[model samples]
Target: MRILHIIHSIDPRSGGPSHALRGLVQEQVRRGHQVSILTTNAQSAEPWMPDDQFRERMNNDPAFSGAELFIARGYGRTRPVARFTWTPQAYRWLRRRLADLDARPDIVHIHGVFSHLTTFAPRLARRFGVPYIMRPAGTFAPRCMALGRTAMKRWFTTLFVAKDLRLAAAVQATTPAEKDELREQFGLNNVVVIPHGVAGVKDAQTDAPAARRALNIPERAKVLLYLSRLTPKKRPDWVIQAASKLLSEYPDLFTIFAGPDAGAESQLAAAIASSGLNGQVKRFGFVTGDQKRQLFEAADVLVLPSQSENFGVVVVEAMAHRLPVVVTPGVASHIYVDASGCGLTVEDSVDALTDGIKKILQADKTELGQRGREYVRQHLTWIVVSEKISEVYAAIIRNQRTRRRNRSVNQQIRLTTK
Candidate 1:
């Protein structure tokens, strides 16, 4: 099937939604489907998501990067983030591109269109008379609003944006929690819960000692890595508090917070200082590409303390690296962690996270890592996700065919009666 993915930025550090799109595109192309991405990233003098290695790899990949790169202009001159979530160029580009394309797509799958790329794309897809699927990627959920800490943006979304999502043929959720969040809190009228997942790396094992040395990690210290954007939603404070508690009990524990500071960097930095963990906490500002993989390799466990996560994609990535994960209980990834025993699940608290890290330290790291890999292999591979997506696309096409047939039969009956 010919599929066009509408995304805000092709930049990888922009996070999971972008990563998921590129991965699926690669797989689809391998399966002999023509996959194209329409985005609104103009020629920036400086790298917009400079810290993202995944974005770098995707940009350089022989298969993925060779695809068309549509750069559009938008309203994000003043702030770094405004460029991503408020770019107005995305919708306009999608509308014009649809008209200009030589062959119409079987489906136009939209990802993260509500931010940076602008909000106009979904409405344009509706106008083109093509069935477009919106993957809010957990942006429209109640949890997202709380995480974002912006009541006004939440209100605007409820009034103007969510209706656009409802207008789409269907919305995609990465997990069951997200699906429920969409229906219950977001009042989503049409939705499908297809796991936005990752495949375990082939021979993903690494030279742990080398990775440690590159990161300057001490051999005696147990590495605790939190790799994601430094944001309030990520609840980095929980990790900091946990670190303070572990300092006395586990003196050799090294707490590393590595990722771009999207909005909450200063706040997290402040917390780290106030906690008086001057020597213990290591802030790597941001990591991408190979640096990211190496950090994962050096770590004993990955910690995601998100108060609200649709599906923590990094949980699977950590598993791929054969690292155990410690995640918040309410997240969609928690379901995977709890069921698979690949990692420990903790409640939303300082002591809870602290205990989780302590418990993880007790377990056999090798066994935990193996379990994590097994979990991803069973529940979250690209092949499994592709099959699910193909089923949804086929279902929509079949439904359209039935509706056309019914309309034709009614016309024939009217002619015969006349």
Candidate 2:
């Protein structure tokens, strides 16, 4: 089957959705499907790279080389969040590219909403009589919609996104909580709950002492990692506040913020400095490859205090590394954590998060980590997730075939009667 993924950006720092897309694409390719991605070079402000440099890196990057990548120009860019455009050039590029495809894709999967990709790409797929699925990727969650520029988001959704949601073959929610949010709050049917997959665990054990030494973390320190963008919604400041509260109780605790800052660096820096927790709270910007692995190995626990997350893929990543997780209730994966008894779910508040961290720290760390690892192994690996998604694609195609057959039979009956 030929699968085309339409997304705003593929930059890893773009967070869970981008990482999920990369894993899905690679796994699908391995499973004998033709996969292609159409995306923009849109990136956030911090850790800035010139457009040409970024594009060159992407093109030459081995991970991206597995699938054909189409990078379109986005308009009206700003720091941290670049608005996707409906420029004439973009439309022309998409149309020409679709025309050039040797075979129309069996399915066009649009991976987030409120962008031109969500509003326009599905229509383009429709023009070629292809089915498309829209995965809002938690963008439409009730709390998620309440964040920055609410009025504009409402306008965009009403004017452009709602129609697409109604038109899509299915709207994917990564968890049952999200499914309920979409159905009850947004009145969306055809909602499918398929959680994102994690890359298989490469090696669960890292040389703990060596990793700690390399990262400059003291041997006696207990590491708590927050490994996502420093965006407002992610509530990195909450983690900082929580760390401040635990300073007296866990003096050796080191809370490292390790990800690209998506317009929240200054705020986080101030919070860390003023709270008198500078020595305890460290920021390591963005990490990948081996550096990322070492951090995971060195950490005793992973924390994601998001105000709203459709599916916290980082939680899965942490669990795969056999690191216990502490996540907020807003995270959809909190259900798995709760059910599997592998992590703690706290309210999205400083006190609640602080308490959760303390509880995990005092518990048997080895047992908790092992439980989380077992849960991920059972349910969150790429092969298992890709198979489920492939089933959905197959079902949609089969339904389309049946509809065409029924129409053909009706036409034949009319001709015979005439």
Candidate 3:
């Protein structure tokens, strides 16, 4: 099958959606399907482009070798002065390009919503009578709209997104929580639950001591890592507070908050200093690629106290590394962790987070980490996810063919009756 993915941006720091796209494309390519990506050339002031380590991995990683990227200029910013990812020129170019393709895509997979692509891509698919799937990437959840943008969202949905979503062959959500949110908001029953997949990292399997040496993490210190975007929604401050609470008991505990600071680093630093958790809490803004793998290996445990996470990609990444996780109520994977005994799920509070951390530390950590690793290997790898996604694509195409066949038969019957 020939598949084309349309996303606002491919920058990894754009968050889970971008990474999820990479995983899906890699798996699809490995499965012998032709896959290509159409993405915006949006560059945020912050770093998201692959660093030296990531470039090296991409060069050697066979999964990434076949996935091709076509970058076009885009405009419009989610934040003031950020990269323009939804430009008019890009939208026009895409429409023209799709029209001109010699071999039209079997399926057009659109990722992210409330962007120019979201508004335009689906219309093009409908115009060409091509089946397309829309993955909102958790944008429809209530928490995502609660930041004083409800009115604009409602207006946008009514005018543009609603028609596209209703006309879509399928709508995909990465978690059950997201599926529910979409159903409630859109009253649509077509939502399918499909979680994002993680590519296995061999560096994650490296010995902890060696990994620590590589990352310059002291072997004696029990590292608690917070790996995600430094955004207000992620509640990075909560991790700092939780670490403060555990400092008395585990004096050697060192917590590092790493990831691209999406305008939240200053506040996080302020909180760390005010709590006098300066030494214990360090903000290593934006680590990715091999640096990300080494950090995962060096860490004893991972914490993501998010206010709302449709699906926590970093959680599974940590799990894949054989590291236990501490996720808050907002994370959709809380239920999985609770059921698998891989980690603890706590409320989105400092006290609860602190207790959850303590519990994981006291338990058989090695066993817990192993359970996490096994869980990811069995259920969350790209190979497994891609297989399911392929089924979705095949079903959509088959249904389309059936509908067309029925129409043709009906026309023939009418001619005979006449």
Best by lDDT: 2
Off by over 4 Å in 3: 44-64, 77-84, 201-205, 416-418
Best by TM-score: 2
**Candidate 3 structure quality by residue, lDDT tens digits, 164-216:** 88889999998888888888888888889989889864433457888778867
What local distance difference test score does each model get? 0.75, 0.83, 0.80
Could you estimate the TM-score for every candidate? 0.88, 0.95, 0.92
Comparing 2 and 3 by lDDT, which wins?
A: 2
Order of candidates by lDDT, top first?
A: 2, 3, 1
Better of 1 and 2 by TM-score: 2
Candidate 1 collision pairs:
53-288, 53-289, 84-116, 85-115, 85-116, 86-116, 91-121
| Regions more than 4 Å wrong, model 1 | 42-63, 79-92, 113-118, 147-151, 186-189, 274-278, 412-418
List, residue by residue over 334-404, the lDDT tens digit for candidate 2.
88788778889987688889999999999998888788888888898998898899999999988877888
Cα lDDT tens digits, model 1, 1-418, are 7788877666656667767877787677777777777765532223453334434544576547546555455556344455454655656567666777576677888886446453666666667667788887877556676554468677667766778777878888888777877788667768898886685466646778999898888877888999987777888878888888888878887888987766777888788888866687788855767888889888888999887777778888888778999998656778878877888888788788899998998899999888878877876888778888988988877776687799999999999999
**Which residues of candidate 2, in runs, are more than 4 Å off?**
79-81, 87-90, 97-101
